[model samples]
Target: MLKSGFGPKALLSFACLMAPLSALAQDATSSSPATNEVIGLRANLSPADVRGPLNYEPTKGPLESFFPDCSVDKQMASELSEAFGEALISFDPENKEVRFGVAYKGLSGNAIMAHFHDGAPGVNGPVLQTICGHPPPTSAIGVSATAVMGDKCPVGNHGVLSGTWQLTDHDCPEGSDKSCISRTVDEQVQLLACGNLYVNIHTCLNQPGEVAGQITPVNWIGKEQNCNALPPKSSQ
Candidate 1:
């Protein structure tokens, strides 16, 4: 037998009381809007952060093989640690559009390509987005019209990586290797919010990757010499 207190009126009141609490819980769990702006400061990325026994040579497949490494080429990454770079990324969770502006210099060799990967600061992850130096055909697979991956990069040791990455899915594509992975826009945003995404710039000398930086969300205000800002000219 149902108790009197469990009547429709009492049940309705109980539900009414819980509704507000449920709404409050949802409000607490929702992400803040300010989390959309992400930044990264890279300095001489090292293989110590990579995970694998591939001997610094990518072994994914035909696609990854395009990024070939020479056993005899000078491993400039060993000293490129002195190199510096930074990236400003704007991510819109609603549209899954990612815009990136990056400046890197002092690389040991020419900037071959750049990408965004999934990994922690001290770990290595698969490349989910290509920022530049991609072939024209494959570049359009998940690229945006605002920028072209095949566009020429800056001439010299300094290179600027600018492009848009339209994440498709997080699943690993067939015929691809660990170096490359697929991620949907939602997964990308979640990773950005979790601070698990990083940008990597690969060079001819260090095909494995020369300079890499972990992407983080932050406010650029009150930050001096930020974004790899050059030091002021010394007094003559």
Candidate 2:
């Protein structure tokens, strides 16, 4: 006793017709390319200059307990108390590039070398990458160095260092081989994500490592978010 236009077969056909439309709507709501897309670069623009509105991710870690008595170099451990610092790293997986900023203080002597090492917390490992400020005797406590994606030296202070290193770069510790280091950018990224990579700053006193920090993934700051931005004018 159903209407001619609304029989069971007609209802079944109508439901079938609407299934794809419902799925299409759900797909549209769930997909967000902006979040997944890697940050792109404009011609002649440096990675640091390619601000967000683009996908930007940041990772950070702490540097502390770096002493000869710890896991680094006991022979060169200094009596100047413990040194400490923090490391901020950004990676562009699409371009196979990395950017880093490190700030440290309370070293026993002049800063000589700073490097990114492949190791776990409290475990000694090989140097995977050399950051700028090499050849030692760079700066003392309160040191800051930055590294960009294409400069000659990957380390600087108060500014971006203009260099890059590939995942395949054979820049390991003096006696180590590729097998001793993170062999690929993705591998390094995974290490960073899991807090396996660390920053080691060498000092004149402790030629090996005066201080170290394990790199850990952190919340991303928007490209336009001014780290130093003054608080919005007090709307008194």
Clash count for candidate 1 is 6
Clashes of 2: 5
Over 1-236, each residue of candidate 1 has an lDDT whose tens digit, in order, gives: 10111123322232443344234323433434446423321223433443321223333444335644322234444454456765555554455656555666677766666667666556666656556564323321222222235533344566455545655565654545334445555555556656666777766666556767776655222132232222211211
lDDT per residue, candidate 2, 61-104, as tens digits?
21222221223333344576355554444445555555444545
**After superposition on all CA atoms, how large is the RMSD of candidate 1?**
19.9
TM-score of each: 0.56, 0.46
Off by over 4 Å in 1: 1-31, 34-81, 134-148, 151-153, 178-181, 219-236
- State the C-alpha lDDT per candidate: 0.49, 0.40
Clashing pairs in 2: 112-136, 112-137, 150-163, 151-162, 151-163
Q: Model 1 TM-score?
A: 0.56
